[model samples]
Target: MKLLLWLLLFVLCWPLALLALLLWPLLWLLSLPFRLIGISVEAVFALLRALLLLPARLLGHRGS
Candidate 1:
Protein backbone atom coordinates (compact mmCIF):
# COMPACT_ATOMS: atom_id res chain seq x y z
CA MET A 1 0.00 0.00 0.00
CA LYS A 2 2.76 2.42 0.91
CA LEU A 3 4.67 1.30 -2.15
CA LEU A 4 1.70 2.26 -4.34
CA LEU A 5 1.44 5.68 -2.72
CA TRP A 6 5.16 6.25 -3.13
CA LEU A 7 4.93 5.16 -6.77
CA LEU A 8 2.11 7.65 -7.31
CA LEU A 9 4.13 10.36 -5.59
CA PHE A 10 7.14 9.36 -7.66
CA VAL A 11 5.08 9.89 -10.79
CA LEU A 12 3.70 13.22 -9.58
CA CYS A 13 7.00 14.54 -8.20
CA TRP A 14 10.19 12.59 -8.66
CA PRO A 15 12.38 14.78 -6.42
CA LEU A 16 10.28 14.52 -3.26
CA ALA A 17 9.81 10.79 -3.73
CA LEU A 18 13.54 10.29 -4.16
CA LEU A 19 14.18 12.48 -1.13
CA ALA A 20 11.83 10.43 0.99
CA LEU A 21 13.57 7.25 -0.13
CA LEU A 22 16.90 8.73 0.86
CA LEU A 23 15.74 10.05 4.26
CA TRP A 24 13.69 7.03 5.39
CA PRO A 25 16.64 5.21 6.97
CA LEU A 26 17.69 8.36 8.81
CA LEU A 27 14.15 8.74 10.17
CA TRP A 28 14.11 5.12 11.31
CA LEU A 29 17.44 5.50 13.04
CA LEU A 30 16.20 8.63 14.79
CA SER A 31 13.14 6.75 16.03
CA LEU A 32 15.00 3.72 17.41
CA PRO A 33 15.72 5.20 20.86
CA PHE A 34 12.07 6.11 21.29
CA ARG A 35 10.97 2.59 20.30
CA LEU A 36 13.45 1.05 22.74
CA ILE A 37 12.22 3.25 25.57
CA GLY A 38 8.62 2.28 24.84
CA ILE A 39 9.52 -1.43 24.93
CA SER A 40 11.39 -1.03 28.22
CA VAL A 41 8.46 0.83 29.80
CA GLU A 42 6.05 -1.88 28.68
CA ALA A 43 8.25 -4.58 30.18
CA VAL A 44 8.40 -2.72 33.50
CA PHE A 45 4.60 -2.45 33.62
CA ALA A 46 4.24 -6.17 32.82
CA LEU A 47 6.65 -7.06 35.61
CA LEU A 48 4.73 -4.87 38.06
CA ARG A 49 1.44 -6.54 37.09
CA ALA A 50 2.93 -10.02 37.60
CA LEU A 51 4.34 -9.02 40.97
CA LEU A 52 0.95 -7.66 42.08
CA LEU A 53 -0.78 -10.87 40.96
CA LEU A 54 1.81 -13.28 42.40
CA PRO A 55 0.08 -13.82 45.77
CA ALA A 56 -3.22 -14.73 44.12
CA ARG A 57 -1.45 -17.08 41.75
CA LEU A 58 0.40 -18.79 44.64
CA LEU A 59 -2.96 -19.36 46.41
CA GLY A 60 -4.22 -21.29 43.36
CA HIS A 61 -6.89 -18.73 42.50
CA ARG A 62 -8.69 -18.92 39.15
CA GLY A 63 -9.08 -15.87 37.00
CA SER A 64 -12.16 -15.13 34.88
Candidate 2:
Protein backbone atom coordinates (compact mmCIF):
# COMPACT_ATOMS: atom_id res chain seq x y z
CA MET A 1 0.00 0.00 0.00
CA LYS A 2 2.76 2.42 0.96
CA LEU A 3 4.78 1.32 -2.05
CA LEU A 4 1.73 2.01 -4.26
CA LEU A 5 1.54 5.59 -2.95
CA TRP A 6 5.26 6.06 -3.54
CA LEU A 7 4.96 4.61 -7.01
CA LEU A 8 2.11 6.98 -7.73
CA LEU A 9 4.19 9.87 -6.42
CA PHE A 10 7.11 8.76 -8.53
CA VAL A 11 4.91 8.56 -11.61
CA LEU A 12 3.47 12.00 -10.91
CA CYS A 13 6.78 13.70 -9.97
CA TRP A 14 9.77 11.65 -10.92
CA PRO A 15 12.14 14.53 -10.17
CA LEU A 16 11.11 14.90 -6.54
CA ALA A 17 11.12 11.14 -6.03
CA LEU A 18 14.54 10.94 -7.66
CA LEU A 19 15.83 13.65 -5.32
CA ALA A 20 14.40 11.90 -2.27
CA LEU A 21 15.92 8.58 -3.24
CA LEU A 22 19.31 10.24 -3.67
CA LEU A 23 19.11 12.20 -0.42
CA TRP A 24 17.69 9.45 1.79
CA PRO A 25 20.93 7.50 2.12
CA LEU A 26 23.00 10.69 2.46
CA LEU A 27 20.65 11.85 5.21
CA TRP A 28 20.89 8.47 6.93
CA LEU A 29 24.70 8.50 6.79
CA LEU A 30 24.77 12.06 8.16
CA SER A 31 22.52 10.99 11.03
CA LEU A 32 24.53 7.84 11.85
CA PRO A 33 26.72 9.48 14.52
CA PHE A 34 23.69 10.77 16.43
CA ARG A 35 22.15 7.29 16.33
CA LEU A 36 25.34 5.70 17.62
CA ILE A 37 25.62 8.27 20.42
CA GLY A 38 22.05 7.61 21.50
CA ILE A 39 22.67 3.86 21.57
CA SER A 40 25.86 4.27 23.63
CA VAL A 41 24.10 6.61 26.10
CA GLU A 42 21.35 4.04 26.63
CA ALA A 43 23.88 1.28 27.17
CA VAL A 44 25.77 3.33 29.75
CA PHE A 45 22.57 4.03 31.65
CA ALA A 46 21.65 0.34 31.58
CA LEU A 47 25.09 -0.63 32.94
CA LEU A 48 24.81 1.95 35.70
CA ARG A 49 21.38 0.68 36.69
CA ALA A 50 22.63 -2.91 36.79
CA LEU A 51 25.61 -1.93 38.96
CA LEU A 52 23.31 -0.06 41.35
CA LEU A 53 21.00 -3.06 41.60
CA LEU A 54 23.70 -5.70 42.07
CA PRO A 55 24.00 -5.34 45.86
CA ALA A 56 20.28 -5.74 46.42
CA ARG A 57 20.21 -8.76 44.14
CA LEU A 58 23.12 -10.34 45.99
CA LEU A 59 21.50 -9.70 49.39
CA GLY A 60 18.25 -11.25 48.22
CA HIS A 61 20.07 -14.31 46.99
CA ARG A 62 21.82 -14.70 50.33
CA GLY A 63 18.47 -14.55 52.13
CA SER A 64 17.02 -17.21 49.84
**Which candidate ranks first by TM-score, i.e. highest?**
1
Segments of candidate 2 deviating more than 4 angstroms: 1-12, 61-64
For candidate 1, write residues 1-64 as lDDT tens digits.
Answer: 9999998877989888789999999999999999999999999999999999999999998766
Residue 55, model 1: lDDT of 97
lDDT of 2 at 44: 100
TM-score to true structure, per model: 0.75, 0.69
Query: Against the hidden true structure, what lDDT does model 2 obtain?
Result: 0.91
